[model samples]
Target: MSDADTARRALALLDLTDLADVATADGARDLCRRAVSGPVPVAAVCLWPRFVAVARQALGDSPVRIATVVNFPEGDTPIAPAIRETEEALEAGADEIDFVLPWRAVLAGQLTTAGAMIRNVKMRCGDKLLKVILESGEYPDLDKVRVASELAIAAGADFIKTSTGKTARSASIPAARAMLGVIGMTARPIGLKPSGGIRTLADAKSYLALADAMMGPDWATPATFRFGASGLYTALIEEIGGAAPGAPPRGSY
Candidate 1:
């Protein structure tokens, strides 16, 4: 595909994010505005749970969905608190819940603990989309990545995300391949989200191309795939030949 075509495709699949520690209501509003101002609307505006209502009001009936994080950056939040966070975010109008899976539990061979958290949070999510952050980069290898992916899927994650972007490493192609391989084997529909450090159209194309290769060319609709990014939106807009909006402060994806 041409750069313009790739940009448009990535734009539609983007989860325009603002998880910065310093994020404010004004910042959330600006993110919402950018989400809809582009050539095509992003799939969602991902923000801190506190700003879900702010984003909802800013978007005001726009087709763009609202996404918020829980147990974010760090996945160690206990199940009870995570559930409460999910409940609160849902009540505040979030359309999707991106929960950071307790990957440390997975690494410690406590798969049951990780799985329980996903299952409990998913129960609260109900019909809402639940994207579990595997924090794949923290795993020792791709094999561990696949293990976490399977656990998340079996535990009822609608999507398995690559990272929280808070660690020394974030999304990587090997980690993504492992996650996608697991997703492909499932009879149930599950999605993949490659977040963090994906800041260019070329970066977006690499993942899109990989998805097409592994899952078939028609597999990556917004519901099935997403690029969790902030800086990437500007690169996509530039590729689409428009004056890009002011880039927002960088945030961990």
Candidate 2:
């Protein structure tokens, strides 16, 4: 594909994220400002729960959605806090909830906890989107990653995500391949998000190509696929148009 085609695809599916530890109200406002101010608009902005309202207010009347993380990068929170966090984020105006799947429990062979946690959040999520973060890197092997993907989907995850962008290992082709395999087999309309360490146009294209190869060219869209990154929008804007002077700085979730 040409740079234009790739850039278009990347920009349309991008989730402008700002989950940094030092994130302030001003920074959240700035992130929202940049999302709408960009050359091409992104699908959503993923923020911490506290900033969901800030983002919602900053993005008033815009088509851009607001997403927030729960159980976040650790994936080890108890079920109560996790569900409460999801509820609070939704009440705070998050359009979507990205809940970590408690992979540590899955790693210990406790599949029931993983399923119950997702089901609990999904119940509260109602019609709102729920993307389960598999934290694929924490799994010992690709097979484990695939199992986690399946568990999340069966438990009612609208999307299965790769990483939290806070791990020693974030998104990888092999891990994403495993998750995509699960997504392709499921009869339900589950999405895929390959996040973390994906900060370049080339990085975004690699995952987009993988999705196209596995799920057909037109399958990945704003609804079915997303790149969760804080720095990638800059590169995409530069590639799609020219310089991106207003692009926000890189951060994590």
Candidate 3:
């Protein structure tokens, strides 16, 4: 495909994210406005939980979904609070929940806690999409990464994401390959979201190509695949034709 075609496809799979600590209502509104203003709108807008309502209101019936994080960059919180956060985000009109997997517990051999957390949140998530972030860079090895992926999928995550973007080593090709391997083995319909440090079109294409090689060409649609990124949007914008008007500064997460 030409660069423009590749970019258009990438744009459709993007989750234009703004999870910065300083992110405000005006920022969320601005993101929402810019997201839909483009010729091809992105799949969703991923942001802090508190801004879900603002994004939802700003989007105002556009196809762009609202996604918010819970147990966020730190996944140490117990299940109850995470569930409460999920409930509140849903109430605030978030269409998707990206919850940080309790990787600390998983690494410590508290596998059951990780599974239980996912199950509890899955119950509350109901039909809404639930993305479980493994924070892959923290895992010492690929085997642990696959183990975490299985636990999340078994516990009912609609998508298994690679990172929270706050970690020094957020997303990587090897880690994404392992996650995609796990997803390909499952009969259930699960998705892959390789987030963090995916800035350029080439970076986005690497993840997209790996998904095609591992899963199947038809598998990585907006429903089955997404790029959890902020910097990528501007790159896609450039690829599509022009830069977004009033583009927000891209952040690490």
Per-residue lDDT value at 72 in model 2? 81
Native-referenced Cα lDDT, model 3:
0.90
Best candidate, lDDT: 1
Task: Summarize candidate 3's per-residue lDDT along 1-253 as a digit string, tens digits.
Answer: 9888889999899888998878888989988987887769999999998999888889998999999999988998877889999999999999999999999999999998789899999999999999999999999999999999999999999999999999899899999999988988999899999899888999988988888898888888989999988888888888889877676545645
Order the candidate numbers by TM-score, best to worst: 1, 3, 2
User: What range of 10 consecutive residues in model 2 has the weakest lDDT sum?
Assistant: 244-253
**Model 3 Cα shift for residue 199 (angstroms):** 0.5
Q: Which ten residues in a row have the lowest lDDT in candidate 1?
A: 244-253
| Stronger candidate by TM-score (1 vs 2) | 1
Which one wins by lDDT: 1 or 3? 1
Look at candidate 2 and tell me the lDDT of residue 12.
83
Cα lDDT tens digits for candidate 2, 1-253: 8886798779889888988888888888888887877777889999889999889899999999999999987888888998899999999999999999889899889999789999999999999999999888777899999889999999999999999988888899999999999888999899999998998888988898899999999999999999999788888888878676565654673
Each model's TM-score, in the order given?
Answer: 0.98, 0.97, 0.98
Tally clashes: model 2. 0
lDDT of 2 at 39: 70
The residue pairs in collision within model 2 are: none
RMSD of each: 0.8, 1.2, 0.9
Give the lowest summed-lDDT range of ten residues in model 3: 244-253
